[model samples]
Target: MTDMASAHLSHDPKWTRAHSIFSAPSEGADVALIGIPAHEVSLSATSAHQTPGAIRDALARYSTYSSAHDVDLRDFSLCDLGDVDSPDHESGEKKVATAVANVRANHKLLIALGGDNSITYSVAAGMWPDLSKIGLITLDAHHDLRDGVSNGSPVWRLIQAGLSGKNIVQIGISDFANSREYSQRAKDAGIHVVTRDVLRKRPMADVMAEALDIAGAGGREIYVDLDVDVCDRAVVPACPASVPGGISADELRQAAFLAGADARVRAIDITEIDATLDTPDQRTVRLAALLVLEGACGVASRKN
Candidate 1:
C-alpha cells in the first residue's frame, strides 16, 4: 500500500512489471491471459478502451501471487503483452488477430480483456485454427452473432475464421434491443441462442449442462467472450447496449466459472469494458481481475 501510492513508486516499471498486467513477457504458462483494452473503438457506449490498465492496476493492488494450485501464476510467466494500438477499427482488429495468434501458438489458454466487442472478431481470427471443432460461448445481452456485419459482431469473424456452423452457442441473450432478423440469422448460421428467460428459470449448473451439450459435446475448443453489458446497467455501464434487466454479477461469476470448468475451453476473452465511462468501477476492475484470475483458476482446476 505504501509503495503503490508514491509518485516514483506509483510508476515504477519494475513493480509495474512484477505485478501489472502490461509487462512484455515470454510465453510459458499453464494459461496465457491477454488484456487488450479496445476502448478506442468506433462505436457508441463501448467504454472498454480504458479498462485494461485500470484492471491491471487494481489486481496489482488487491491480489497476490498464489501457489495453492501448485502453480503460482505470479511465479509462473504470465505477462501482460501490453495493449495493441487499435486507435482505428479495422487496424485494431488486425492487431488483435496478430497478437492473439502469436500467443495462441505457445500458450494453452489465450484470454483477452477487450475495449469493445470488436476485439472478439480479432481474437477469433487469431484462435480459430481448427474450425472443424471449435466451440464459442458468448455471455452477452445481445447475441453478437451477425452475418459479417452484425454491429460489432465477433461471431461473424469466428465463422469467417472457419469455425463450423454447429459449434457456436450464445448465452444470456436478451430480446430488449436484439434484432429478430439477426437472431434468426444467428440461429440459421448454427449459433444456439440461450435466452435470458431460460437462464433465469434454471440454476446455473443446469445452464452449464445445456451449454456443454450445445458447445462441448464433441471435444470442441472453447472461446469465451464476456460483454459487460451482460451485467446489469449499473454494475457495468460502460457498454452502449445495456438493457433494463440483465444478469447479476453473481450470475456472471458463475457463468465464467462454468465456462472455465469446461475441459476444451482453449482460449478466453473478456470484452466491452469502456474505461472512460466507468468512472468509479473499482468493483468492475476487481471483477475483471477475478474474471481473469478465475479463468486461470478454471484451467488450473481442469488440470488438477
Candidate 2:
C-alpha cells in the first residue's frame, strides 16, 4: 500500500497547477502580469498594496485548465514582471507608466494587478500616452469621477488627461454607492453607464458587447478596470465599497473573460481589494485569482 506521505507527493498529469504557468519574463509572452501596489491614495482606508502577492499565492489553489472555455492556460506563455516599487506616489506612477510602456509592446496582453483603483490612471496612462487613442471600460460600483488624486478619481483624471468621455463605458455603477454630483459628472463627461439594475436585466454577453463596441469605437484599443467592489459585498468583503445588491462573483468572472477575449482589449487591471481585510476563508483573493484565469482564458480563445 502507498504511504500517506508518498501519496501526497504524487503528481497528476491531468491536473496542471495554475501558479506554475507564470515565470520570470524571457522573450515576448502571451500575457504579462505586473503588480501596481498603490494603496497610499485610496479614498477609503485600504491595505490594497498587499493584494498582488496575495492573489499570486491564491493562484496555487486553482488549475491552468478552464472547462468553460475548453482551454488550458499552460498552452500559452505567461510571465510575472514583479511589482512596481512604491507605485502609490507621483514618482511611483511615473514608474508604473514606464514599466507599462516598456512591456506593452512585448506581450499579447498585459494584466496589471492593482494596489488600488488609483492604479487605473497610471496603468492606462502607461498603455497609451495619447489617451485619445484608447477607450476605457470600468467595472465598478462607483463613478470614480471624484476630484483630486485618489482611487476615486482615476476616471476623471483620465478624462482630463485626454480620454474622451464618449469613448468611456462604465458598468455596474451601484445605487447609493455614488453621489448625485458624481453621477452628474459621469453624465457631463458623456460616459456611457450601465447601472447594476441594467446588468440584472440584460445578459452579460450583450452588455459586454455593447461596452466593447462603444469603448473600442474608431478602432481604439481598450483598457478594462475590473474593480472587485462591483460585486456583492458578501462576494467581496475585501472590497471597501461593495454593496449588498452588486453583481455576483460569476458575473464579474464572465466580464473578465469577455474583456480578455477581445483583441481590442490591450490591458486590464483588477483593483479595490484590500487583501488584509479579507474573510477568514480568503474568498476575495481567491476570486481575484480566478478573475486572472478567466482573463487568460479569454486570451487563449482569441487563438481559436
Which pairs clash in model 1? 38-115, 39-49, 39-115, 45-240, 47-273, 47-274, 47-275, 48-273, 48-274
Would you list the C-alpha lDDT of every candidate in the order shown? 0.67, 0.90
- Over the stretch 102-133, how does candidate 1's per-residue lDDT look in tens digits? 66567667667776777776777656656667
Query: How well is each residue in 1-304 modelled by candidate 2, as lDDT tens digits?
Result: 1243134443678877687799897558989998998999988788999999889877877889988778988988899988999997789989998888866678878899988999999999877889999999999999999899999999999999999999999999999889999999999999999999999899888999999999999999999999999999999999988999999999999999999999999899999999999998999999999999999889999954
| Candidate 2: worst-modelled 10 consecutive residues by lDDT | 1-10
TM-score of each: 0.83, 0.95
RMSD of 2: 3.6
**In model 2, where do residues sit more than 4 Å from their true spots?**
1-13
Candidate 2 structure lDDT: 0.90
Q: What is candidate 2's CA lDDT for residue 298? A: 93
